[model samples]
Target: MENGNGLKIMEKNGLSLNLKLQNGTKVDNGTHWCFRGNKELDTPPEITIRGVLGMLKDSLDPSDPRPTIPLGHGDPSYFPCFRTAEVAEKSIADALHSANFNCYAPTAGLPSARRAVAEHLSADLPYKLIADDVFITVGCTQAIEVALCALARPGANILLPRPGFPIYEARAVYSHLEIRFFDLLPEKGWDVDLNAIEALADENTVAMVIINPGNPCGNVFTYEHLEKVAETARKLGILVISDEVYDHITFGSKPFVPMGVFASIVPVLTLGSISKRWIVPGWRIGWLATNDPNGILKKTRVVDCIKGYLNISVDPTTFNQGALPHILEKTKEDFFQNIINTLEHTSEICYQKLKEIDCITCPHKAEGSMFVMVKLNLGLLEDIKDDMDFCFKLAKEESVIVLPGIVVGLKNWLRISFAIDPCSLEDALGRIKVFCQRHSKQK
Candidate 1:
């Protein structure tokens, strides 16, 4: 049946999942039946980088022209201390000057880029990887997209970490893949619950996704914890998709351990990018490396499926691809050391100050990523209703913007970024303290 807008009508088991202009009107028995009219596409929740920025802009006070503090967004460009590495800049400049890179590269990405990424990532591995096992992506997000597309098979489900990157869940949902979520035990320093994973898996399970140095949790996993996760995945015959975009940016007592270290034991698909390390979110260059030493992925033809999907997909810019080798090679050790040192100092400041606030509690100081996840003790405040309410009111009242935990799938919690300049971070913390005290029940 055709609707007024020319959208084809479709029905699923019993639920009516809206497609074009109209939303699912009804779901009978677990099945979706699309409306029979051509309707306009509905606006999805503000999930994209640009959409959130727009929301933040709309929430700003018109009387004030000064830029709003953007702790809500992940990009570090707002901080002068996080400026791109000089060698990264020079490498990209050189690539722009190289006339050979002006042409449209392969859809799967340039061979040299893949080779450079393979070499750069292979440093932490016990086994060497060939360039053929590497695939260059526009960013780690696309790598997750491609992986989900390739792994989609009927009746097969993928396990994802709850409060995980929604892109993984979004991509899987769009591809008609079933999603099974396992818990990250926050009490145990954000380690995966191996028992939960085992219970979630069956013969139909294909892969499990884990974000090392977790995104919202802000806790890095110990080697023993990672080993158990690998063992559990191996026992279930599922591949591991390791999201390591924040791989080395840690200030915690525990070290960041890459899941690729266990490749010999079980197949692993490691996704990483220089965006976080170099503070170049706009660069949009990332890599997906297959760490299957036993060739499990190759034997299953997963590698070919990934390449086939990439052939028809968009790729990273040619110039950025051309700059990979020099960016990897010429970036000085001092630059990385300095960035880590700064992150360490800022994390300490954020952590210590958060403790003094009566209404907010941080589970752990962010050990790795650019952000920290803190629980909002709603019981302690009279004005705050919930996480979103808290953030909305805080933005209006303080002109400070912080991500609500609901955005990351954790309700009543907030994710705050401490990646800004030290003074600004302290200032923001001061604003937060004032907000908490103002809303405190005693007042």
Candidate 2:
């Protein structure tokens, strides 16, 4: 390396190592060895959604009359059928009237709100939980972030679902935690591949995240499957973080099973929100419920670790916290039933339509949640290259915006949200069919 004086700098005798500009100009080695920033940053994240939607933002014309059909986000509040219940709105308004909620809430959460979540969730568990076991978070997203941050340690690892939510991966990466992915076998209607999880875990693994009524795949776990998950986590000597954010939206053959039911055998951290069930995602109230009936989490001080972390975290708005019980109880039965019916009908339309698209295949009809994960057969499409390319082309050619499955760590597959209004869902599917047919290999 040459210094500014055009003197050749010796490797060993120089004050520091090779330090020079790209033009071989002299630079202080201090800039080169500036310590304490993440060095592993350039490494691609194990999963993310960035590249999936990159091209969509650039290609769309402002004057185009066709609206963007969003099947990428899970929220359906924009759809009439899935809007928040009127009673929920009134309860939140009522809570706002109380000056008592104006102060900063306790770090763990507001006491009354925690108690309400505990009582509501405990209705399904064999063992009851107290307010101390419930921690209010900004939303389920933060609940997962806190759990991952709390459990992360040097050389520590965590297991995640392959075709799962990417927020887990994002938080894990930010916390510098190593991640090992386990597959949910689509062949078996999206059951967890136990052997794969067993292969991934060792002493370093601190926890495994399981999504019930899964995110991208949308199939609910059976009690038997959840029992096996609990047993596996127990054997691996790690905790289970069950994300039940989509708890009761099932319309398939199997019902949604709460993993907390098996908490007696293994410590479980349950993450949930009022987002899906109550159709109030923007309200952003969620809870992190610790279910360790055997007290393993308490014994290990994991519970305390979570509390310490929460002390530095933000709580859900105090007003939203106060609205918990009312939202849980007062949301009418008819409102709940109508949302489920809308989801089911929309999912059926997607399923039937995708089957007819020559280039695409749905492995399983979505039974819960708002999305379905489908495999795109590249061999059947003429111009598209892969999932990302296919989605880019689909968005450009058809004005439809479905998520590329590669965002969820699965390639050549896509997760489509059918949670929009029925007519919009119909339009999106029609566009998808037209796009596929126009690009078909047969064409």
TM-scores of all candidate predictions against the true structure: 0.89, 0.90
Cα lDDT computed for each candidate against the true fold: 0.83, 0.85
Per-residue accuracy of model 1 over 306-378 as CA lDDT, tens digit each? 9999989998999999998889887888898899999899889999999989888887668888888888889
Q: Residue-pair clashes per candidate, as listed?
A: 13, 0
lDDT of 2 by residue, 1-443 (tens): 66675545557764655554544444455444334435445545324565445456555555668988888778898877788888999889999997667878888888888998899898888889999999999889889988998898899999999899988987898788999999999999899999998999998999999998889898889888899999998898988999999988899988877889999888899999998888778788898999988888888888888998998887889888887778876777888888899999999999998888888888888989888999988998887888888887777777788888888989999999999998999899999999888888863
TM-score of model 1 (CA atoms): 0.89
**How far is 45's C-alpha from truth in model 1 (Å)?**
2.1
Global CA lDDT of candidate 2, please? Answer: 0.85
Q: Candidate 2: TM-score?
A: 0.90
